[model samples]
Target: MEIGNKEDNRGYWDIVWNPPGERTGIFDVIKGTEFRIIYHDESQAEVSFTRTWDPSLEGKAVPLNIDKRFIILRGSSGFYTYGIYEHKEGWPDFGLEETRVAFKLRKDKFHYMALADNRQRIMPMPDDRLPPRGQQLAYPEAVLLVDPINPDLRGEVDDKYQYSCEDQYNNVHGWVSFDPPIGFWQITPSDESRTGGPLKQNLTSHVGPTMLAMFLSAHYAGGDLSPKFTDGEYWKKVHGPVFMYLNSSWDGSDPTMLWEDAKVQMMIEKESWPYVFALSEDFQKTEQRGCVSGRLLVRDRYIDDQDLYASGAYVGLALPGEAGSWQRECKGYQFWCRADVDGSFYIRNIVTGNYNLYAWVPGFIGDYKLDATLTIASGDDIYLGDLVYEPPRDGPTIWEIGVPDRSAAEFYVPDPNPNYVNRLYIDHPDRFRQYGLWERYAELYPDGDLVYTIDQSDYSTDWFYAQVNRRTDQNTYQPTTWQIKFNLDSVSPNSTYKFRVALASSTLAELQVLSKERKKDLAFSYLHPSFFLSNVITGNSSCMINVLAQVFFNDQDKGVPHFTTGLIGRDNAIARHGIHGLYWLFNIDVGSAWLVQGLNTIYLKQARSTSPFQGLMYDYLRLEGPCGC
Candidate 1:
């Protein structure tokens, strides 16, 4: 078993797996571990290596039986690897921090790495990250290559985390050796076994000339994504069967075509899922799995009275939880598929289990959860006829800022600071992934926070991608508050209005609302009324009470907020260059008594300022008048 080096104190480009001594970081190698031939035939063969844990070595080794398997088929160029992890009910309690298989190619031969069509590049050598060649940045993981072996790469920043990709797009990526016209790729046909849903971001190929098949890690999402077993709980999971694919061009024409060919092979493997060749009964075959088919339709009266086809909707089955729990769920398997243009979807080969069907449309604001649980018995073809989803809508849209597509891509994403850039995303579609973008907020808004006025401001250019803290000095960060100004032609004192605010991401932050009267306590303008305050209805209802936006009142001064999303989210998407994290929606209600016929300004305050990284990315925001209006 090849284990990685210590967490830190290791060289920049050192071979992470097995440095000097046989010192494993988190997982310990089992004693008397042996490999056994499961099956051997002219057509195919299967082999297994067993590592059993000893309770006596509880503190030393992971209290779980790790079964690693390898399979090879006739006329196949590459092999398949998978692992079965099990922790019995009597096993001692422990935390599983990280587990993965890594491959480090010969640096001399493989120099080009491809994560995606647009993300591929000829990378700098690991030595380029060492002193005299590279300069370490804010974190050890980031190194600016001052002088690289490939002079073209000089001044470019090389960070493994920079290449991290979401699980959905992480199907095939690897290193290319132009010398031999060969390609080494890690192809994950499906991510049903990986944790944190399809949008979960994990490390892919990086600067060590390293390619990782990440089964579990705390890369983008923090410790919460890492599972901890307590009181000897029994847990078992099948991590992979991910294919290690290899291809070569004999003609020596276009060696990069190997990447294109690897992509073709990836589709071949995906279509051959639930392989019937495996010897282990734990590995279910096609006959043992079930299928789900359905047609989803959306009924948003504001858009159209008739049911609209849920085009390009992400529909999936996950361990039963709340509406949006799939993003944070890690313990169970999840099967996801996009709805067709006609809103029809077929989820096949689902392992027999009880799951809740969850979905979110591309242009929709809220999530859709089927009220019932689905039971997938072997060979069961379950058809959930026609399903209609009515998004969270209570009234007509008086004013809407951005699209509610669970992404901040529509907002203004500033260009990365000239000093620090990842050339790949400069004018690229993923411009939001540039480094130090959070700091740009402080530079752009040097004096005051962003103030967007409806009809006058364009979201694409006016609204910033994220609401990050304004760095006051070297280490001090001040909380930021954005204002949305809109004019109301009339006021209805007896009606209730809905304020819908959807956040694409947030990191350990508190979003608050102070009463208009108490706004002075924080920082307010005596000329304008703000927050959820009574008796000061000069017009515009700026102070509306939201579900997650904590509203402070006179009697509840410094007490519990009327509504508080206490320290929500830990995905750290901002620092990781992720466009969004776990989705959050806060629906607030404003009474007619708080409104006036004039210009209204609602102050959206992000009250957390401990770290500059703490922030929020708004997916969309809309103020809706009463149902009839």
Candidate 2:
């Protein structure tokens, strides 16, 4: 089938048919009849073609062998184009035709029309013709082109819509509207887009795929992949010699060889100093002491020996490793042989402390002496110096000495027993009399356990105990006396015992009266005596008065008892025959005591009398031993 113009200059066409394969026998029978043409055009052109023939020469009015030709005028230019499309066998030969013409050439101006004879056959359509509005064209099933880089855009026109290169160029050129603004389209010198060129260099040297892959890995892993940069060592480790130049001359007047030799000597002396003498004093007396015993080997003999030693030298030493400050007991010292000699010596001791070492030889006005403060630990040998001693024109002799002071002693008091009573006697004879009485009573009944019978005979005023005067007027009641006794029978022999004694006025009214009179006394101003007893006994004995009573009374209250005048006594004792007046007694059998084998307590009591208004009534105490009756 042919659909478009064939040598038809008007750009119009018709369909004429010739079947693909020829038929024979009965099916090939006959065709020959009037035929008509049909066509369409974009410009509304009109045209037509027809034929009429008789087929009797083959005994059929429409003979199968009959063929015909017809013309379809297409345009006013008379240049109408048509197509011959064959639909069936010998259809063209049967005088059938179809034509098309541009609408510009037709008087009716209809853009599309159709014509045909009684036959039902229609003309074939050209593939290039535009479809009706909103109508889709049928496309081929197969794909033809493939692009690897942008495979999504590759295919036959039928399989995918063709994207116009013009549109792509316009979008890239910033001429057409795009949802996202177009970026710069970098071009090469040749005026072509540079999409295929290498991408811009990464400022951080992160450009290539490998670098990108590494970066992605680091980001995902959350750490750097490269090794960290570092400076290996932090602290410097120093060792070897420490060369200290003392009076060394800066000018070349002192040979370099001499200085170098001296430095080496200093190192040798530092090392050998400890072996010779452990202390500086040992080195100062002898040449074989400390490092001085080592030979002095001079490297520069040509240099003046006097100049080498006298040119304001420096002292130095070699250490095994880094050395800390010297410690206690150890010291460093140095001595030079002579001011003009080329040799000097150093002494290092394991002992530490401040030290001074000196060499005092005749004819040498300058004594080589060095004083060093050092604290050396055990096993430490410190180098002191290659001291250079210059001779003074004249001055006092420099002597080295070591003087150490003695350490103080440590003393502490041990615990004391609380049961033994201590007493002191002051200046008055009356006070001594009373105190001696108490003492005698304790000696007789030393076990501190004693009992007393208080009756008319015991109440005599003669031989009563009294105390002397004290300093203050307020407490000027004669001598201050205390009578304390303990029950030793209740206490074990050689065992410690404690007791406490307290004195209080028998009545508040009496205490007030006494306090009024003794308020100005020195004894009254001080704390009242509270006696404690601590003692160990040796044998069975009864309660005994172990403490003496003394008085410190002022001149104004001369011969008066320093304590308040009142009846003093311990509870739980035998009743005493006396006026309803105040009475004083010490009971030994009442309180607790610790007794051991062969030790017993003696019971005893001594009495004395005093009155706030009357002053001292008695001046003596009567002491009695344990009853053997």
Instruction: Note the Cα lDDT for every prediction shown.
Output: 0.78, 0.21
lDDT tens string, model 2, 355-448? 3333322222212334443343444445543444443211121111111001000101111112211111122211221111222322333343
In model 1, the runs with Cα more than 4 Å from the true position are: 1-32, 516-549, 553-560
The numbered model that scores best in TM-score is: 1
TM of each candidate vs. truth: 0.90, 0.12
Q: List clash counts for every candidate, in order.
A: 2, 96
Q: Residues 1-629, candidate 1, lDDT per residue (tens digit)?
A: 01244433221111112112334435433222778999999999999888787867666566778788889999988888887888899777766656766777777788999988898889999899999999997678778889899998878877787888889899999989999888999999889888877878898988877888887766666656677777778888887788889899989689999999999999999998977787787778899999999999999998797999999999999999888778767777899999999899999989898999999998888889999999999999999999999998888899998998888889999998888877877789988877778999978989999999999999999999998999888889998888888899997668888777888887877666665444433332211101222221122444632224455432325444444445666768888788887677776776676666887777777877988889888899988888887
User: After aligning candidate 1 to the native by TM-score, how far in Å is the CA of 300 from where it should be?
Assistant: 1.6
In model 2, which regions exceed 4 Å deviation?
1-493, 506-543, 546-607, 610-629
| lDDT of model 2 at position 436 | 15
